[model samples]
Target chain A: MSQRPTAAGDPVIVVDRLTKHYRVADKDPGVLGTLRHFVRRKHRVIEAVKSVSFDIAPGEIVGFLGPNGAGKTTTLKMLTGLVHPTAGSVRVAGHDPFRRAARFLEDITLVMGQKQQLIWDLPTLDSLRINAAVYRIPPAEVRPRIDRLAEMLSIGDVLAQPVRKLSLGQRMKAELLAALLHRPSIVFLDEPTLGLDVNAQTAVRAFLREYNAEVGATILLTSHYMADITALCERVLLVHDGALVYDGALADLVERFAPYREVEVELEHPVEREVLAAVAEIDTFEGRVVRWLVPRDALTQVVARALETLPVHDLRVSDPPIEQIIGRLFDGRFEGSAAPPTHPPAA
Target chain B: MRRLARLIGLFWSTAVAGEMEYRVNFALAVLSSAGGLLGALFGLSLFFGDTDRFAGWSWLQALVVLGVFTLLDGLTSTLLVPNLGRIVRHVRMGTLDFVLLKPVDAQLWLSTRDFSPWGLPDVLLGLGLVIWAGVRLSVSPTQALLALVPTVASCVILYSLWFVLATMSIWFVKIHNVTEVLKALVAAGRYPMSAYPAAYRVFFTLVVPVAFLTTVPAETFIGRGQPAWIVGSVLLALLLFAASRAFFRFALRFYTSASS
Candidate 1:
């Protein structure tokens, strides 16, 4: 997709060159350094988020993709006004999140997968009512909105149970419902589907998509689950070591980094390894099947040649999985660092 | 106003429910807390045995002060202690992130997050002693002398003082020791300020106001009512409450949630 300037005016969240550096104390083992450490404490600066920029239009669903410690969570925290950026400008709903003014807080909500906002020992229903009062939503509308969300998420029964007794996925749904009960226009979800089963993950993804459409809420989600990004997000912002590495359409990212589809052929018999190498970089080779990393544009040509020349029996070609592409991208070894494994790569 | 109070009540009940999950631990905790106050009362009795009217305050009057202090201490421990203890860990672990994103004031949330229903025993025992003192010293303690109003007001003031110090955790990230220090100060309230001298009352009533926490309030029931004491206690409580709120907001400026 070509770059298109958003017409949504100034973007709901416009973060430019955001940075966060934490000062951690430095100490050595043994009683000597420990003793002196208290007298003259020394600190080392660790940059957690370094010069990241992104813009999300109204109603945009963007995925923040990266491995752990990639600053995805740091960026989300700054956007939600939960944390301050060391340097840079972050304006969510046209107000500085760090300011944490009542108006700005009212327009946004954040959900953390590993953390919960519900009162742990209370029934979710009680927590929901509390949140309603907290956000000052009209009492008349709270129950209906809550009921609709509960029904849609299939969490109505769980709402009566204590939060501690509910399953992780159940608690997560309740959290999401409570978060949206205030009708926030901008939602920040950090690892919302983590530790959930595949079915629960799918259910959550669907609910999020529906909620965004119904409420016109802009969503920025950070998840290590590539399937989450592949299924729900239109665009993805990739962060690496506290910096924005790539920001564009999810499809475009795969297209750019994984520009080629992988092709694999199962030969009738084990052939000389040179023949497999001659066609393309042999990804893997075992008894009969061999795999090659070939450009998408050259897939047809390579497959045709392999079928004709090599005692070829069967062959297939497909785009590399998002997980493999991402692993290669972070490792910086996608480009000819080593020969691809020789095997019939699964589509 | 009712809605807010009800929300706080629910919060309190939830805390009780969390603790109830472990019945053995909860029973032991209640017993230990009760034992602590029993020990304090026993110590007070021993001291009274030596001098009935030490420092111009009688044995029963001293016990009144001790009773009020135990009640106030129980309230702080059951309601404020657990939550205040968690402030540092919340800041370090980023749990405060969830608290802030909510629509309520961060200070209000932290102050009311946890409550220990087990501490009810202390309140009951304290009330029994206060009534027993009231009956023994009845001497037709007039409507004016019944100091129940000011006594309750003083409890509110003392609790507010603790809230102020606990809220300081928002500013000084390593304020886990602040509440412990406050508890130590409360321990000093068990004895009469008159024994130390008039100067200590002035210091505590003005500087830290620890005296009003128990002594001035207990004095109300013991026919030590003074209009000046009532006015001073209320004014100081309101002033301290306002100052604590301002300090809390000031601390918010430096608060950077974790991983942000």
Candidate 2:
């Protein structure tokens, strides 16, 4: 699954049993509960990230995927030194992230889609200048850095416009420019393309790819969009319930989890459900079309049998959407129904 | 140190540019500041209507305290309120994550990121009143120079107090009103410490330390400052400033960024 040769010197990011626990106050949803809470508060400790461990090589773009509360963002926060892990260890760029030494911070950047650091009332350039000063990029280098990034991001025109006036896509691009102005060696992005139109999402993905290629910066990003992962990352780390469920190539993930393919049949006439069930597991049935979920090994046999016996006008076989496969995986449907094979068959 | 100063200059310049968008607000700010100053002067006059001295200090001496209070209040609006007051919002919105991720010191960034020129009117008027009172008192040049030490110390103490309160928002994310309460108490600085009752003076001196914010500075300005009080004022400012920085670091450990 990992076709790229591992970096020579060492992994840029090392995480061994990294974890975080948060103590959250508990209260019910009534005035009486509020009174009770006020009298004696009760705190429950939640293990947000539970002993998750994975290493990322330099210049590798790894997608962090999970359902809400899966600790992907929490893990990113710890790696970026925004939050301290409760247990285990994480070393990024030869520094303990929790220490957040200046040298360590200079080498890393984090961008969260929903949270913006730009000043709302000011022009995007104003915020960029502040970033420049904070990062101590020499004054002479600031303009060229901004110009280069703005060119890559295609946000040059909007840099002087107030952030509030720019579209969400423009603002996100400007944010990327500011985040990358210092040329960090590692970038942590949480849903960078979130809430953007399709074209904007594509633009941001392209910018990230170009930036990574140009600077050779390691990137770890989490997004709900499967296209983002497929387009940007060859490798992915999937987390569920505060634990690492899978970490491997994107292709391997599809092969291992989605062992079945979808076969769509355009029938000449309607067929009985019982008769169709003999050929394959029926996914959907209508007047003249039938869809079946057939195992990878049995797909050809099932299609042959369906064509021979059934009044088949046409048939096509393709893998299910990755989003659907992952959604079902998290739903625990695949676990009970089509138990994943321990090892992927030889390709 | 030079780098920090440069950064602050950049921060304030950008802040001014950002604020310039609302040019009319500056006019309103000046109007309100003038109204506030006049109201304060009127209130002070009530105490001195019948006598030149109250609480063993002349009216001019008390006006010095009022001037210091106005100066500190202006500084608050200019720096502390605009910057530290947003800590709660940042904590709630999770933008504090960006601050922490920056290579610069988070405390420095948060404490000096904003500047409001609306307070400049109060600052200038306050300085004018202080100098006017000094002229009437025949204050020597050395006394004026010496007075600056405690004035600067008062600014530090005031900043530290505001920062400590703001930093608590990490644990209690809705503590905005708590800072307002501190402001209400610090308003006591408008009068000399001797004007207050014994209990009020004790609370102001020991608990909130409002006495050191204006009264001690005013005493120094009038050339009646005791050496012990001046030393105490500087020491208190340094201690509180250090404590505020330590407190900010401690609070950050508990910062659970708002769940995305």
Candidate 3:
């Protein structure tokens, strides 16, 4: 529930203590188990999302990060009114999302990477036309709006082609075009760049940035790729085991979780381990090169002393990669005892 | 309302354009329709072997019942099967989430999302049979137009039944064959209600409602329908349509979309 103060404006999305529980049927494997299940069924409740609260301001791009089954998609579903929340309140675009009022629906769009809304056998333009009619977009504006989005996504050529005939990247871009055709003010994207090549991922990222810039729409995105987050989002919300673990600036997260900087040094000659240890904690060394893990507070002093005392040929200082830090966080390396519940492995 | 109409227009045009990609399927559909009609006529002939009347109705009057059944079957193929048949797939694949996210009514969207022109030949042939039979019977235009009321009512009733069964996929998730069972039961509508014995007549009329679908409409076509029955047909259609809408909304409450 921890959140930094949002920018000054009426927040477009206000989620308060949102939670969801699913009553899943529990069954064992084998013929006997099937007979027993058929005769006497068993059910268990799974708490998918727990008391998650956050506010998103207009025109803000927030990254929602989580591991598999961390309930990221569940939260997005609640916000989009696709699934009802088991408990708690969600207000998006000044209306209760589950009510799904026409006005509220007109103001929001959701794009899931693994699912598509476009007709597979039809040309992409056909699906877009249906969207225009569903959203009641003016006849005069539909063509221009489509052209503008197609140009931005660089998917103008594929509009007339059947969706199944397009490449994965082209299909994803077309999905985005269909989703955004109504000019929704709030866009919820779940793994929008998933399974795309690096080049396609970068293109999608760039298109999102430019689209957000042009429309000033609020965006909440979830992606397994850190590059997607780093490129488009300045703020991030990290969820683990169905709970919000961190919410703030992405840089602040790295700063807090990873407290040391990596300094690589190339020595003029092989240096004794004791000499390098005197300046900073030695991480690794090979012949003339040494890597040091220096605390943030001691970075300046350690670098200055290294130049004064050691046979330092060239030195470079930088923070560890964000992926490594986030990976460690999820591994519970920092908390030591944050063990998640485990169920019986599926048969 | 206008937006809904426009959306339907767009949905069907796109659907037709997509189905056109397989022009050969349309030819296959026409051939199958012709073959099916011939088989139906042959089956009807079996009941009329030493007598020109079946269940107290002349051969021409019985042809009207078969025509109504053919028309409904065509409608089923053109709209119900192609659209409702996908509800199970959508529920399984999690694409229904996108359907609910749209600004339009989810039931309407699901119901009219796709159209197949493959069933058009059956519809035309069915209408032609009804007209030819009417000509042989020397029926008046006013009486023929009166038959349309029950025909439209039959269409609504059939749609509601198919839709209600399809909506059950939200819970069952794997009942694609359930509709096939319903289709088999509805096949009884191809014959007049009088063709069955007392027990079967009651069963078809009350339980499965095959009587109202074809027999009642045929009765009205030949100018022998009871006023109470026509009123009952309209009322049943309206009632079932409302129930289908309510049932769909109720089903959605339990629609735990498949995990992404």
TM-score (chain B only), all candidates = 0.88, 0.97, 0.97
Per-residue CA lDDT of model 2 for A1-347, tens digit only, reads 43433555678998998889998889987999999999989999999898888788999999999899899999998998889889999999999998889999999999989999888988988888878878889899999988899888888998988899999999999889988989998999999999999999999999999999999999999999999999999888888888787777888778778888899999888888899988888899888888998888888899899988899889899989999879977885555234432321122
Q: Runs in model 2 with CA error above 4 Å?
A: A1-5, A265-278, A285-290, A303-315, A333-347, B21-24
lDDT, residue B95, model 2: 89
Worst lDDT run of 10 residues, candidate 3 chain A, spans A338-347
Mark the 10 consecutive residues where model 2 chain A has the least summed lDDT. Answer: A338-347
lDDT scores in order: 0.79, 0.88, 0.88
Task: Tell me model 1's lDDT, rounded to 2 decimals.
Answer: 0.79
Report the C-alpha lDDT of model 3 over B1-260, residue by residue, as the tens digit: 88888888888887787689898899999999999999999999999998998779899999999999999888888988888767888999999998899888888899998899998999999999999999999988888888889889999899899999999999888887876876786698999988888999999878877889998889999999898999999999999999999999888777778988
Tens-digit lDDT track for model 2 on B98-158?
8898888989889998899998988988898999999999999999999999999999998
Question: What class would a CAPRI assessor give candidate 2's docking?
Answer: medium
lDDT of 2 at A283: 94
Q: Put down candidate 1 lDDT per residue, A1-347, tens digits, no spaces.
A: 42423446558888888899877789988899999898898989889898787788999998988888888887888898777788998989889987788899889999898877787767888888778877887889988999899988989877888889998889899989988888899998999999999999999999999999899999999887888888888887878888776767777667777778888888888899998888888998888988898887788888888877899888888788989888987885556323332111111
lDDT of 3 by residue, A104-194 (tens): 9999999999999998887898888888888888999999999999999998998999888999999999999999999988999999998
Which runs of model 3 end up more than 4 angstroms from their true locations?
A1-5, A336-347
Compute the lDDT of residue A142 as modeled in candidate 1: 89
lDDT of 2 at B74: 87
